[model samples]
Target chain A: MRRVLGVVGLLLLWEGLAAWGLLNPLYAPPPHQVLLTLYGLFQSGEILPHLQATFTAALLGLFWGVLLGGSLGLLAAFSPLFADMLEPIMLLLNAIPRVILAPLFVIWLGIGLASKVALSLVLVSVLLFFAVYGGVRNVDPRLVERVETLGGGRLWLLKEVYLPSLAAWVLSSLKVAVGFAFTGAVVGEFVAASRGLGYLLSFAQSTYNAKLSLALITLIVLFVLLLFFLFDRLERHLLRWRPRGRAESQA
Target chain B: MLRVENLTLGYGGVPVLEGVSLGVGEGEFVSLVGPSGSGKSTLLRAVAGLVRPRAGAIHRAFPPEALGFLFQEDALLPWRTARENAALGLRIRGWPKAKALEEAEAWLLRLGLQGLGDRYPHELSGGQRKRVALAQVLALRPRLLLMDEPFSSLDAILRTGVTRDLLRLVEGEGIAVLLVTHDLEEALALSDRVYLLSQGPRARIAKEYAVPFSRPRDPVGVRSDPRFGPLLRRLWQDLEEVALCAAS
Candidate 1:
């Protein structure tokens, strides 16, 4: 209740600042204008297709990130030889800025959603890969020994110890990478797209509609926040065994 | 029966123990004792296959399923409930979840961990977690057990009770135990025979003593025994010499 009230108060303060002309209405439009624009977009249903395009790309990217990154990370952890073999190559790939590849992705994938999804995959895979890789590598050696001594083979040890230990790490990195995934989608759209939030932002920028641009920025921020909230809830629900440290604040 | 002949273990160019040979007859209880850095834990680890010995021949009558190890730390899976943690070994051995959990529950009950099977590791007390850890290995019903200072972290009251409980179980089951400890009293109380490890890049057995106490032993009785005090003093003297040699 208090958190909701605090947010409301901040929104009212922004409204008051805009009404008094303390803030420039051209660049920082009032909250009501943004809210009205959102409502207009909703009624017209013009945002749906673009929203769908962006979300579809993000979902595909997340799927690949979780699947391939997780497997490769666990594999690397199990074999130091594999780690040595692939680390240099992975580092070389990671060193190349993913955003810089948008033009190349556009050239290769065309101006379609494929390029955007590909760009998002590049972002999410690196983050997710490191998270799972570190998680797998950090399992307690003593615990591994305990399992091995009980007649468990390598397969058993990996299933019981490595995978479960990596769960928390995977979830945490996924939350962080979701934002990057969205950014990747937007950047890809900015490079070349007929749809999505990035295209809308670009369109507004080109037309010099500062209010619309600000409104679109606000919508993207809201989308990111919603994604974070959803993940936070998912983490709590799936990992109930994990202790909640700041219960008072969370509550 | 198990035999570790001329076992040499170390990392890279450094050797922790060398020319170390030991044998455990069927159902025998042996304890390895030494001062800090004496490689007692290293020896147990070598037997458990956690440490690859640089050179040695370790012959075991049974396969991996017949050997269990209790680490110094509980090492319980943080994400798993107590029952799941206890059952992990069985699950790894290819048992179904239901059967594995049933076996884990039985061991948990045997270890007086009834009604706490669903609790996660962080929800358990230190003593309770240790008990769960013990049950995890015991659930496998291994013929040979390698324990690396399993009760070193407990308070005296808890330690005494746990030690007594563990001894009773091992004796009843007729399992072989190779325990490592720095506590002379613990080594004296539980072991059928005790070997003192000397420290070095090539540490060797400095002294071997056959503990004369009978099974179902108590600390009070062992402390009162006339033989106990002199044995302690002798082991202490031997350990001091080993430490001096190691320092040199």
Candidate 2:
């Protein structure tokens, strides 16, 4: 309740500032105007194509990203030679801000869903690679010994011990991965695309429609927040066995 | 039966146990009692084939899979419920899942952990988890049982109850037991024979005492036996002597 009130209070302050003519309307639209634009975009159903475009790319990229990254991570953990071969390439990709690949992806894959997904996939895979790699090391050795003494072989150990231990780390990375996925999709659209929220934002900026740009930004936040909330629910359900209070990020 | 002859165990070229030899015959209950840091666990690991002996031969005629090892910690998989954990070994050995789980549940009930099969390890109490660990191994019906202070973490009351049940179960199953513990009283009340390991960097089995207590003895009731006091005191002094020798 307090958080909602605080947000309302901030919006009221903004609305009052614009109402008094203390703020320039063209550059700094009132909160009510941005909200109205958001509602108008939905009401007219004009935002549907752009929302569809971004969602398809983000979700598809996320699926393949986790699959490929998680596999390579397992391989890297099991084989030091593979780790040595893959580390330097991943490090170089990771060393730079990854979003800069948007233009390169556009040039390579063209300004389509392919380019958008490619960019998103790269960012998420790199992030998950580290999560899974480190998660393997974090497994309890005594537990491994226990399983071995129980006559569990390597395959059994992987399923029983390694996978469950990796779940927490992977899911947490997935939360961050959601944000990166959208950043890839939108940024890829911004660089060069006919339709997407990023395209809409660029059009709004070029036309000096500050309200429309802010509305688009708000739409993206709402979507990302939805993903975060769903993933949080999933992490809880999967890791219900974990003792509470270990990590709500403080750990 | 199991035999460790002139076993020398070490880590990375540093010898921990030197010339330590012991045996546990069929249906025998043997305890290896030693001071802390005396490589008692290392010896147990060697018997379990987890550690390579620097020099020695361990003779156990049964296949490796016919043995179960209980750790000092409860060592239940936190992610699995008690039933699943108890069923793990049987499942790994190609038993049908339903049969394995039913056997696990039965073992849990036998170990006084009825209706707790659905609870995860973390949800169970320390003593409850310990019993579940016991159920987990016992469900396998291992011909040889190797325990590393499996009851050490429990409180006094809990330990006595668990130890009593362990004595009865192992003897009834006719499974040979080789236990590593530092508690003299635990050794006296529970074992047919107790081996005393002197202190280390190169710990050796300094002495062996044959317990006069008979089979299926009440681990708690036998503590009142007149001979129990003398054996306990003798072992205690012997432990102190080893400690002094090591210190000097």
Candidate 3:
């Protein structure tokens, strides 16, 4: 209840400032104006295709990036030669600003969903790769030894130890990756695309339509928040073994 | 039956154990007691095939699968429930999931952890976690059990109770045990024989004593035994002499 009030209070303050001209109405529109513009866009059905394009691209990128990055990370952990040879290369690639690759992806894959997904893939894969690699490297040696002494082989180690550890790392990274995935799609669309939130954002910027820009930004935030909520639910289901803070606080 | 003949182990070419030998007979309970870094854990690991000895022979009458080890740390996978953790060995050995869970639950009940099989390691009390770890090892039905200070983390009262319960369980199963502990009282109270290792670099067993207490000994009754006090005093004195010798 207090959280809801906090948001409302902030919106009211913004509205008061804009109404009194204490803040520039042209640059920073009030929350109510942005909400009205968003509702208008929805009612006209103009934002639907762009929203669908961006969501589809981000989802595809996330799926492929997690699958590839998680597998490669596990492989690198199990093979010393592979890790030694490929880790520096991966680090170098990761250091490159992924946003800079958006144009190149567009050039190669054209101004379509493919380019956006490819850009998002690059952004998310690097995040997930490091998450899994670090997680595997930091797995408790004692736990590995315990499994080994129980007559477990490499398969058992992967199933019993590495997978669970990697799952946690991947889940935590998913929150961060969701934003990057969205950024990748939007940025790709911004570079050269006819559809997507990023294209709409660019269109609003070119025309200096602050209301439309703010409305698009609001929708994007809401979309990312919806995705985050879903990921949070997935994390809770997967990590149910984690001790609840509520119980500890009560104690 | 298990025997380690002239075991010499080290890390990075620096000796930890020098010419150490020990034997555990069927149904025997033996313990190695020493100060921290005295290589008692190293010796136990060597026997468990986790550490390679520089020059030694470890002969076991049973296969690798028939030897269970419990580390000082519970080593329970935090993600797994008590039943799942206990069922790990059986699952790795190719038992069906349902059968493994059923057996694990049975062992949990046997270890007095009834109704807690679904709890994760973080949810369990220290004593309960220790019992769950013990169940993980015992469920494997090993002929030889190797433990590294399995109860050192618990408080005195909890430690004694768990120790007594462990003794009852292992003795009833007729399993041989080789425990490494820093607590002399724990070693003396539980074992048929105790070996004291001096401080290392290249720590060696300074002395060994046959505990004359009979089987099925109660922790309280054995501690009250007429010989318990003198035996502990003598062992402490011997340990002091070894420390003095190392210092000199």
- iRMS per model, in Å, is 1.6, 0.8, 0.8
Residue-level lDDT tens digits of model 3 in B126-240: 9999999999899999999999989889998998888888999998999999998878887898999999999887898889999999989887679999999999999899888
TM-score of chain B of 3: 0.97
Task: Encode model 1's per-residue lDDT on A140-236: one tens digit a residue.
Answer: 8877866766667777777777777777788778887888888889889988999998899899899987777777777778888898889888877
Model 3 residue A180 distance off true place after TM-score fit, in angstroms: 0.9
What DockQ would candidate 3 receive versus the native complex?
A: 0.83
Q: What is the lDDT of residue A193 in candidate 3?
A: 97
In model 1, the clashing pairs are: none
Question: Pick by TM-score: which candidate is best?
Answer: 2
Q: What's candidate 2's i-RMS value?
A: 0.8
User: Order the candidates by TM-score, highest first — what do you get?
Assistant: 2, 3, 1
Deviation of model 3 at B35, angstroms? 4.4
lDDT of 1 at A24: 90
lDDT of candidate 3 at residue A33, scale 0 to 100: 91
Fraction of native Cα contacts kept in each candidate?
A: 0.63, 0.77, 0.93
* Superior by TM-score: candidate 1 or candidate 2: 2
Given candidate 1, what's the lDDT at residue B167? 84
Q: Score residue B1 of candidate 1 by CA lDDT.
A: 92
Worst 10 residues of 1 chain A by lDDT: A242-251
